[model samples]
Target: MKRILVIAIPLLLLTGCMHLNDPRPKHYKAPVTTVANKVCVIVQPEADEQIVTIRINEIGNDNNTLEKYGLAVIASAERCVTDFGYAFTAGKAYNFMVILESPEKKKRGVQPSARIYGASFSLWRLNGKLQATPLY
Candidate 1:
């Protein structure tokens, strides 16, 4: 029993250290190197519109190229917030989309508070972080 215990413990410990040198996402077809890092998008708030609940998500585009770069979605959150931001890998440039939704009470005559806004940004990371300018 003692001999078996000693051998099994070291074998398990060695398994954890085997992949310490290689750092790459597990699902990629090839190794990815270029990435934008931390990217942020500034969401504009409308004074006329009252916001009670706000949810922002990095939606899949026509190509659905979020993970194709490096941006991964955290559950339904998508790593995007009311601030609206995300970063992706380089190599092949692809479109990224965010759906920011603010639901309000339904008005009898007016349309629901739901609205979809779209914009393209040309921004890069500086010192591992980038803040997006307001889309106005």
Candidate 2:
């Protein structure tokens, strides 16, 4: 029993050490360009009264090349409050996420341009007014 216990402990320690050398990239890259004109917002009905979720979609062109970059919380909250009207309680916060679609690239004569489109956003709410904060 003592021999097995010694062997198992060292193996466990080695396994734990192996996890410290993870190879995945730790940083996030920002998008190169954003297509503002093509955008849409969808609200999801929630069973919970305290929390609400809204999904914002930034769509690409006719080619259907779309990529979800991230969410813009403040912009979405403002649009929702303006268009949908605010009936929720003041100080009640909502969660928002942005869905990004890849835009079709156009070649402007000899130069080929690639546009990186994505989304990002933060928490928001309406407390006598609409507010948004960009998430990091």
Candidate 3:
């Protein structure tokens, strides 16, 4: 009986010393790139300021994830005109078709603002090179 207790206690204590490493994946893979469907921009001329509304429709498999890309395109458009002396005719609205790059993976849109839209376009792409006839 004494021998059994001594051996059992040692075995039980050794079991707690064993270590097990985590087996989960650690690498991060970015979403794949896909072609955007439709792109449009609306420039509203106000008395004091011009409001630019860039509409990027049909972005990726997920409808929500496009806003980030949309804002990026808007910023690029603003910067493009600023850097290259591009501006819409004053007191007039303008429409344009743009091609944007987007990721294939679907992700949930997390913007707090309900009005915010996500569209993605690079400075070069938004440089009036890819403009098409207005769908409207």
Off by over 4 Å in 3: 1-42, 50-55, 59-65, 68-131
lDDT of every predicted structure (CA atoms): 0.35, 0.30, 0.29
RMSD of each: 18.0, 15.2, 18.3
Per-residue C-alpha lDDT of model 3 across residues 49-134, encoded as one tens digit per residue = 22133332222323322121233223333222111222322122222222232221112332211222222332223443433332
lDDT of 2 by residue, 1-136 (tens): 9999999999998988975635332222222111232122332211211112233322222232222233322332223211233232222232223322112212222112121212343223434343433333
Name the candidate that leads on TM-score.
1
**Could you give the candidate ranking by lDDT, starting with the highest?**
1, 2, 3
Question: What digit string (tens of lDDT, one per residue) describes model 1 on residues 1-136?
Answer: 9999999999999998987744331221111122345443323433233223322323334443332222222213222322333334322233333332233323433343333333343344446654343222
Q: State how far residue 86 of model 3 sits from its true place (Å).
A: 18
- Please report how far candidate 2 places residue 57 from its true position, in Å: 6.0
Q: Report the C-alpha displacement of residue 39, candidate 1, in angstroms.
A: 1.2
RMSD of 3: 18.3
